[model samples]
Each structure stands twice: as structure tokens, then as C-alpha cells.
Target: MPITEVFKEEMGIGGVLGLLWFQRSWPKYSCQFIEMCLMVTADHGPAVSGAHNTIISARAGKDLVSSLSSGLLTFGDWFGGALDAAAKMFSKAFDSGIISMEFVNKMKKEGKLIMGIGHRVKSINNPDMRVEILKDCQTAFPRHLAARLFTGSGEDHHFKEAKSYPECERFHWRRICGHA
Candidate 1:
């Protein structure tokens, strides 16, 4: 290869590979924006999953790591899964070419949970705060693809219209939950 081609191949391929290798060693070296966001969200309140675990561990006289790990492990298919559900629901709705009530009904039949619809806490059932935060993230980092992934599927409208069982929307906000 010519000198220019050789340099391009090495710099283009090697640079990305080198960065990936270095990332494992510098997990805390995220940009200032992400670090700041993490700090901002660190202690929103005890209702969050991590707070629940820490409180449980402290009360039980267990160590901090164990308690935190207990809480982290609990964040699946229930506590932390709502956002993922919403993302999937939006994807489905977007792919189907409509964010209408019909799309929601079809997805419900297919077992896709709507994201950001209902909350365990916050009786108002508003997801706009979370949306605003995400919009802020998008503003800060214009290249974020997840921002583009938001299909604006009219999920909020469908959720508000579809009456669900009270128990279905109820989230257990207890401090000390048993192991899964």
C-alpha cells in the first residue's frame, strides 16, 4: 500500500481498537457531561432502587457493598425495566407507522409493555420530566443515537386513555424487599 493508505489503515483501525482497550482500564474517565449527570442523579431520593438497598443493608447491619448489590440486582423486569419497555413499545409503534391506539392494542396483544406510561410513585402519571431530562441529554450530546430512537409514539396519549387495573400500575416501594 502507498504511505497514505498505510497511515489511514493504521490510524483509522488502530485508533478505535486502542481506545476500546483503554476504556476497560478507565471506567470513571467519562466526559464531564456524563459525570455531571451522574452526580446530579446520585441522590434523587430513597424511593430509587439503590437507596432502598442501602437503607435495608444499613438497618440490617450488613456492609455497604452487599446492600448496594442487593438493590442493583433487584433492578430487573420491574423497577428498572420500565424505560426498556417504553423504548421497545416506541420502536414497535414507530415500525408499524403509527403511534395510534390501534398500535398500542396490537403491541399489548404481542406482550410489549409501554414505557414511561405509569409509575409506582408520582400519582400524577406524568413522564414529561424524564422526557425533558432525556431531551437535555440530547441537547448536550447531539450525536446521541438513543435520542433519535425516540419515535414519539403517542404512548402517553394511549396510556392515559387505556384504563388499567390499579394493581398493574402499583409498584412496591418497600425498603426491605426479600431476595429474588
Candidate 2:
């Protein structure tokens, strides 16, 4: 059903949104993933193209919806576009029955970057708190680990080790057991 059908129900807006997502038959715990994405996108603020454009539009006297749409239009496959790119890449690889390593290799061979495989400010040393927070939801959103592991470039060894989030729970488990 469309969100319009969902909005017809006399329920909380969150409930309506959740129902719409659930109806679309995404992941098992998709609402949590959606919530996380919403929080991240909302906090991006004016630094990103979409939010910056939205600010410009609002300042130029556009209505709220128009400003929002204008901002959205700036979210093409480069700026503010990683989520869509990652999804498309992952889906294509999955549909082709390729493993993560194979997909990484293909991209490397073709001189293409994996859409969600690297980051600028985040790294193994300093780390990103946003990624740390999102790690708890890895079981619900395994796809996001693609964003967390910041390889300077997609090296073969790192990509091999990162085929799955094997260490996510183990690190926390060790810490809990006074082993960290």
C-alpha cells in the first residue's frame, strides 16, 4: 500500500511510516534501519548539498515543501547519494550471486570505488561515533557495515576480512568479559 493509504489510518505518524515500510517487505527489522537513516540524515544539517540547498531555497522565500523538494533534487548520485548507490551496488551484486569479496574485486579490477567502502573523517584509529552507535544495529542492518569500515582504498585483505561483521559482537563480548 502507498503511504497515502497508511496516512488514512488514525495512528501516530511513526506508526504510519513504520507500517508503510513493513508493507513494502524490506528487511525483517526495517523500521529500526529506517529510524537510524532518518536520524543520520536529519543531523547532516546545512553541510550537505540537500540541506544547504534547502536553506538557500528557504532564504529565497520558497515554501517549506518547495524548499525541501529543491534540496532533494540536489541529492543526485554524487552528493548525499551514498545510501542509494550502496543499495544499488549491493543489490546488483546480490542478484548476480556474488560474495562481498567478489564484488570488491570486480570494482577494484574495473577501477571503480565501492560506493560505501570508504570514508574521509572516519578511520580505524579515531573512529566515528555514529558508526559505533550504528554497530549495535548491525544484525538489523548489516549493509551499514559497508560504511563503517574506512579503508584508505579498498585493499584486498581488508575487503576479505570485512566480508561480514564478524568482529562486531566479539569485541563487545570481550569488553563485557573484561578482556578488552
Q: How accurate is candidate 2 locally (lDDT)?
A: 0.62
> What local lDDT score does residue 45 receive in model 2, on the 0 to 100 scale?
55
Cα error, residue 173 of model 1, in Å, equals 24
Per-residue lDDT of candidate 1, residues 1-180 (tens digit): 344744665534333333444422111212334444555565445347756776788789988788788877767664677777777878877897985788878857987545678654444564436556745654454222222223234233333345321221221101011111
1-180: candidate 2 lDDT, tens digit per residue? 565655575344444454454433333344455566667556555448887889899999999999999989888755667778889989999999999899989998997767766763466877777766676766554433333344434333553466644564344333323355
Give residue 99's lDDT in candidate 2 (0 to 100).
Answer: 95
TM-score of 2: 0.34
- In model 2, the number of clashes is 0
Query: Please, what is the whole-model Cα lDDT of each candidate in the order they appear?
Result: 0.50, 0.62
lDDT of model 1, residue 48: 76
Clashes of 1: 1
Which stretches of model 2 miss by more than 4 angstroms?
A: 1-47, 98-114, 117-121, 128-180
Identify the leading candidate in terms of lDDT. Answer: 2
Superposed Cα deviation of residue 104, candidate 2 (Å): 8.3
